[model samples]
Target: MHPLRLLVVTLLIVTVNLLFPGAAHASPAVQYTNPIAAQRADPHIFRHTDGYFYFTATAPEYDRIVLRRATTIQGLATAPETVIWRRHASGEMGAHIWAPEIHFINGKWYVYFAAGRADDVWRIRMYVLESSSANPLTGAWTERGRITTPWDTFSLDATTFAVNGVRYLLWAQQEPGIATNSNLYIARMGANPWTITGATTRLTVPALAWETRGYKVAEGPSVLQRNGRLFLTYSASATDANYCLGLLTAAATANPLQAGSWTKSPNPVFATNATTSQYGPGHNSFTVSEDGQSDLLVYHDRSYRDISGDPLNDPNRRTRVQKVYYRADGTPDFGIPIPDGLTPARLISYDTPGAAVRHWDFRARLETNVTPLADSQFRLVAGLSGSGTVSLESTNYPGYYLRHRNHEAWVQQRDGTTLFNADASFIRRTGLTGSGTISLESANFPGYFLRHRAGQVWVEQNDGSATFRNNASFTLE
Candidate 1:
């Protein structure tokens, strides 16, 4: 291989060894379901060092700033929520309460949100609320006034992160001279969490064809640090189905204040995955799995496409979470927004690294680059037969599940029979092959294990050979 190619391959191998299989088991990722929270747009999930995933978002009513906390990502779905603050009756913080994000800064909790005047609902501006108590829900909050920018234009969706001990704020704003509805900007902080210092740097605008649909917009900024680079993501277009995500990348070593350091991707990264029936997926925040190893994408979208009247008047946009994978080059491969019902994953075999367990034409086997994509994906749901077992339900097939009939693995629809439940269930255990993988044992046939032979899947008795371990062991993706 070329020298550079060799280096890239080495890095990829190291990353795969470090991030997958082992990190996969740290969280019960399958327990999650889509639409984690309903009528919550511009959602933000912050995994604080307190071992809690703090959540806040734009309420469908556009009225109050609310918060929820849970130890695990899925727990947030039903965790008790508290209204930390509400909109004022008049003046600056009176109307259009939107996109609230909670952050722990300088031993205190701070919330950044956008608000408008009661009389002028569209006159939105970024505002702050501070709490000295560690538990933000029960703590008393004080209004910290507005985050004043160079020019007093419409600004919202404020997010902040610290790199090299320097804290910087990234937000969406309408510049006085700019023709676009909004542009992304970044600036270092002065003394407190609510203030910005120095000249602001414009990072991205609505220049692409897709970004200009419905509205000339570039907003909802979020940043993820990985692969020795800063990946800044922003939402664009109107709030309707046209809204999508765009990315801006810059080297970690460069001066971020210099506009030349960042490069904007010509196309959107994650958008409305029609195959998944998820529409207008945008305004995302990044958080890690409970293990602090696997990165997770947090965002919101509607289950349906069309709206009755104004899209903003519709309240179905809901919060969702999914795993984030990386390419060999170390960039994030967001893939697509998964379909609703339950969280989906691909069972990747250890031996066939390029392929995953997929069902094609009702035949369960390993395949690479499967089309419709959903054919290769499945949900690991609670066993239909009993507790302490798992059933792999086909992502696209829905009611159908991967089952063993005459020891052969196949995707078959449930007939509502006791035998069908047992045939579809399997007990997950430590890899029969080795570490960084999992083994599924037949729930009905005690000694039988799901393995691959000649690229075909089968539930067979383990012979205690290295080949059996290699064939039976698979990693959750």
Candidate 2:
């Protein structure tokens, strides 16, 4: 072969390899093994600068600020737990620190959490603690001071977000003028962390049915952004199983400071199990997993049955997580309550195999030169070889993306025939006739196989199944 021919063949082989790197990987939604972690609630998860996940939650029985770090969600549970801050004396700073949040701003680390006087749980106010190191685990935290505002009333659940280089703080409070329960408020940050630039603008009050469930409240705000829109997701209703999630959104072109600028969703975005034992599903924070695929929603919910409707009495509000999704429009559609045993969608990884007929939530890897399909009928391109983890998705399916290995992997399309591509144009559907030679990709491993008649594409050991019909229009598994 000529030198140019050799280069073309080599490039084709590499393109195919990249297209279907993992042909025999796990199903994206395979249930994650539990207990991912134990006894955590009001989870505050943040992806650290160092590519690790840092998590904090409400320590129900203790007065200390707890922190956990891990490379993966499952690893977080086993990662050693650290108590960074504890209550001080008998005064407002001495007791009942709740919903602690850690943030890295400027050149140092700051922890924002609400604490109350030892004797009174209602005196809860948000305070800040500082650390010097970039890596939080190695730093020593110094008490910065209580974040103050214009009002002297009770407040808690303080959170901050920076928009277009402007910093803003939000919290729940009972202003002197408002007679109802705690409402949500937002304000601009001043020169120092302690100062407020202007009067706090009231963002929301109890209006929706979910917001008025137990105490007519709306608090615990966490923000999500997409397509130049800002979404403020907050917990509402009583903390019992009735606890739910609500949204407030505004366009990037709108004034974030104007109270009317943010539009409230008429219905709750996420909620608790009306039939199941899960209760009070609120107080959530969002984070992206290591692979940067989907948004993860981290909140606390009661695993056990709730005898009382009151949010305060429930002791089992443990931390839980589920994948957050978006609708056809830019708005979010936080689907039904995900069960505790439900596994999170897998992040696309290099070693994963991606082949499957269903194309269920698997994604493919893309490079500039890779060609997916010859035509809609499914033809292979000689310039491309199904070499690496093949990332491909079905056109008609929303949640389906599959990656599989090349040699041992097979795909059964809607016609129910085992298939593989040739030259990106022709289709050749084969039959295993039995389950002996199949494998399915998984969250932690490559591929596992079962009965062939079970209707799932299986892979051989260490094989990836991420190939598809068309390269140009295809998405990887």
Candidate 3:
């Protein structure tokens, strides 16, 4: 070939390499850190078709409805919030604005919230706000008026969902004949969301001992539909440490307005786990992850169990989120609320697809079968600087981190030792698969990579073989 032709080919190759560097290496897995927004309770996050997640929750003051949107769930944490609506100074909707949920329906955005009148603070009722704009965060929200119930009584936590081409509204209210503070009810909604068309049916009351712990309350209902079943989860007890979640299940084809169609779980489905130091883990909403592969539970909880006076006055109930797992029986397994901090994740070995990297007796090893909660979870934190490095902190053992000493990985306690910091941090890199896989290179050892050999983890130099590449790659879940 002529020299001019050779030069042209080399230039083209260089241009292609520069334009698509990722084609030569694996892309980093998408990961998100949680507690998306702090000091915000009753979080309702909905991912719209516009590729943004709109978040709205009850402000701590309980005087206004605030909203924020972001391209990613974690981005909502720092996104500027807009006060869409505020409580009136006197008449109805004058006080106690709570649990505002944003929904897009029939080309309009609707916000359903619970509010009370200034004269009667305890007389809580549900109301709706409508926005015609595509983006709810920037639009003008007009009052759609109150959602009146059959009996004039306390009603709140209004949530709406459509199944089989029919929309239904589910909420908690104080029934006239029932002695309990509130009960779960459902009614078919009319053309407008603020109006209910059919007869209301009481689904569940605070009859169980667990549901009536502090206050005979059954409120804050949220829905999750899967596997031919409709799961309606609601908060029970009081809004303190006794606060928990209860489940009411019905078939997808069953008539939602019929009280006989639903079966209430005898016990609370999700409750406070003292082991995780999370109290009052209730008022949950569900959303799918950005990738559309994982379902997340968005809720609020207090880090501490003790509150100053009334739990209602406590401002520590902050918004949090976690992955929701499903059981083989087609039911949701809302395990315990994980401890607060950064989001916890699992490390899956690429060599053996389903195998996970776990710590047992402070030693890191590849376990084909591992327990879900403690052993396999780690909080991946950015290392010392923004140098594309990371440190793995054990979820169960607070300050302990994954460190390599003498070429083997072990869970070591971080005791302000210089060697510990140097050994614990690993430089994150693209995986061998060239997409959504992660490879950790030892920060201190430079060229060495974290790998599993004979089920034990070790730091070794890459051999550029299929086995070595597979051993070094991991999926951050």
Candidate 4:
């Protein structure tokens, strides 16, 4: 072979490797930190096909409907909100605008919200606005008039979803003959989302002790369909600390209009967590992560247990979001309302595939095929010493940091210990394969990188091999 030809071939190989390293590997799993927006309630986020997440929530004042959109979930926190519509100055929709949900249907945008009259704040009724613009934030939203019910009574929290080629509307309302303040109801939606075509059927009433706590309520209904079933979740009890989420399940093939077809969970599927200090967690909507890989639960909760005035007027029910998992039986597991802060994320091992970095009894180890929660999650925080490095703080252990002692990783309290300063900090670098994966190189030990060896974490120098690169690389999800 000619030397010139061999040299040309070598140069081409190097250039290709440099330009697209690790391109053969699958893309990393997407992860997001939560509390996407603060002080916003009845959160609704939907990922559109145009690769953006559109978010809308009840404003603290409950006086207007606002909309925001971002390419990423974390970006929604800083996205500028646009006031698309405001309450009427008088008559119906004059005050108390709540639980506004935006949906794109039939090449147009429709917003479903509940409003009440200025004179009678408790006379809440459902209303909608329509916009022909592609971008809901920039278009005109014309009122479509009030959605009148059979009986003049209280109703709110209207949500719409389609199954088996039919669209249905689910909401909570007060039946004239029913003693409870509100009960869950559903009906087939007409061509206009604001109106229902058929008779409304009572699905579930607030009859359980938990549901009847402060107020006999079953409002704020949201829908999630999976595993051949439709899961309808609603907020129950008062809007105070006792507020929680209740679930109603029905087979996807069954008639949703039939009240007996749905089975209500005997207990609240999601509720307040005293350990996390999150109270009154309810009124949740679901969306997929930016990469369209994971399901996310978007909801509102009070950071503190106590509120000074009426819970509805407290204005502290901030909007939060977290990843939602599923049970073995194909049921959605909301887990618990995570505490306010950076939500937990996992470190996926590149070499071992499904393995992840997990802590057992304060010692970091590689756990194979384990669920990424609690011990497996770590808050990737900025380095303590302003070095542009990163520190891994345990989600479950709180103040503990992942520190290397004698080249092995261990979770230890910060406490200003000498070892915690540089040992716990790492400089994040591109994976050896040059993929989106990350390699945490020890800030103190320079060439040494964090890697799992024999199911244990160790700081070791790179051996410049594919095996070594795979061992040292981790997907920061």
Which residue pairs does candidate 1 place in steric collision?
A: none
Q: Give the clash count for each candidate.
A: 0, 95, 1, 0
- The best-first sequence of candidates by lDDT reads 1, 3, 4, 2
Which numbered prediction scores highest in TM-score against the true structure? 1
Q: In model 4, what lDDT does residue 185 have?
A: 87
Query: Residue 159 deviation, candidate 3, in Å?
Result: 0.3
lDDT for predicted candidate 2 compared with the true structure: 0.61
Off by over 4 Å in 3: 1-30, 207-210, 249-270, 273-277, 326-335, 339-341, 360-370, 384-388, 404-412, 443-449, 452-465
Cα displacement (Å) at residue 276, model 2: 6.0
lDDT-wise, the better of 1 and 2 is 1
Model 3 poorest 10 in a row by lDDT: 21-30
**lDDT by candidate, in order shown:** 0.87, 0.61, 0.84, 0.84
Cα lDDT for residue 388, model 1? 99
Off by over 4 Å in 2: 1-35, 274-277, 308-310, 344-477
- What are the per-residue Cα lDDT tens digits for candidate 4 across 60-88? 89999999999988999999999999888
* Model 3's TM-score against the true structure: 0.82
Least lDDT summed over 10 consecutive residues: which range in candidate 1?
A: 22-31
Query: Mind giving the per-residue lDDT tens digits that candidate 1 earns over 113-157?
Result: 999999998999999999999899899999999999998878999
Task: Give the clash count for model 1.
Answer: 0
Q: Write down the lDDT that model 4 would get.
A: 0.84
Identify the candidate with maximal lDDT.
1
Candidate 1 local distance difference test against the native: 0.87
